[model samples]
Target: MSLNIYHEARSEPQIGQLAVAHVTLNRASQSKQTVEQVVTAPKQFSWTFLQKSYVPKETDIFVDCIQTAMKAMTSKDFTKGATFYHRHDVRPKWAQSKTYVAKYGEHLFYRN
Candidate 1:
């Protein structure tokens, strides 16, 4: 099994959609299933853990990076918005490890 990540264009420019990278799973239990695991924006994730010193802005580049990374992992092609990481202090260790990295300009953020 694999996880895919990609991006899609929304009706508005600022409001982007960070969709699944779209991966094909090789499972004996079933033929195929397309699941949409929606998540919050990357910036939103950071606010939970970051301080006043760190501020994150949403950018197309950052979103693209997330999509690229997810596609690379799943080997599936998609044009969805990129994936990003947010840090919340109360989360578990396993949850934190399931994050993906998205880069905005010169900065990078993690996505779950």
Candidate 2:
């Protein structure tokens, strides 16, 4: 899960990463999908889909950043109540119907 955050959040801000982490955790608990399933569900966060060869190494900063992000996640929080998110550059048909919740960095978070 941390690896997912490290890869997906590296290009985003701390807040963006925090949001992604929280959303992933929320989906993991509420939905039957595992962390990988939640993150890589079709066109969601596409790092895994784009680069299958990518692997996150355990650097001190990576560990610390993910830890902080994970620590900030509460059951009450889900990226400002978003269960879904995607990059601002791409507009998936799925997002057109969902209510926009918040935007952090290059990503736009949404809820069903």
Candidate 3:
């Protein structure tokens, strides 16, 4: 399984992109049966399910928020388009706290 992100720049004011994931499965098996004394049968079955998440950035908050929103997003919100933004003040736990103010309209993006 793997994830792929594609950017589609439709207009200057619009940030366009698409993120997708691909999954593939393979299976193999060997069986043997003997037909004697009223016949006999052998059967086997196996399957696997895998899930993976993809995000635009590696930041902890970004991934966390995306997963959160995706889980909470409704069918309409997903179908139309919904964007989630974070403040510029957002920082990872490893970073030291600092007093900084972000300019207006610093964090923004379009989502679908």
Identify the candidate with maximal lDDT: 2
Q: Each candidate's lDDT (Cα)? A: 0.31, 0.74, 0.22
The sequence of per-residue lDDT tens digits that candidate 1 reaches over residues 28-90 is: 112333232222223323322344222224455455545554544555423222333222223
Following a full C-alpha superposition, what root-mean-square deviation does model 1 have from the true structure?
11.7
Our tally of clashes for model 2 stands at 0
Candidates in order: C-alpha RMSD to true structure: 11.7, 2.7, 21.1
Q: What are the runs in model 2 whose C-alpha is more than 4 Å off?
A: 40-44, 74-78
Off by over 4 Å in 3: 1-58, 72-75, 78-112
Task: Name the better of 1 and 2 by lDDT.
Answer: 2
Ranking by lDDT: 2, 1, 3
- Candidate 2 local lDDT, residue 6: 78
Report the error of model 1 at residue 69, Å: 5.7
Residue by residue across 1-112, what tens digits does model 3's lDDT show? 1111111111111111111110001111111222111111121101111222333344653444334324332212221222222234565332233222222233322222
Candidate 2 local distance difference test against the native: 0.74
Best by TM-score: 2
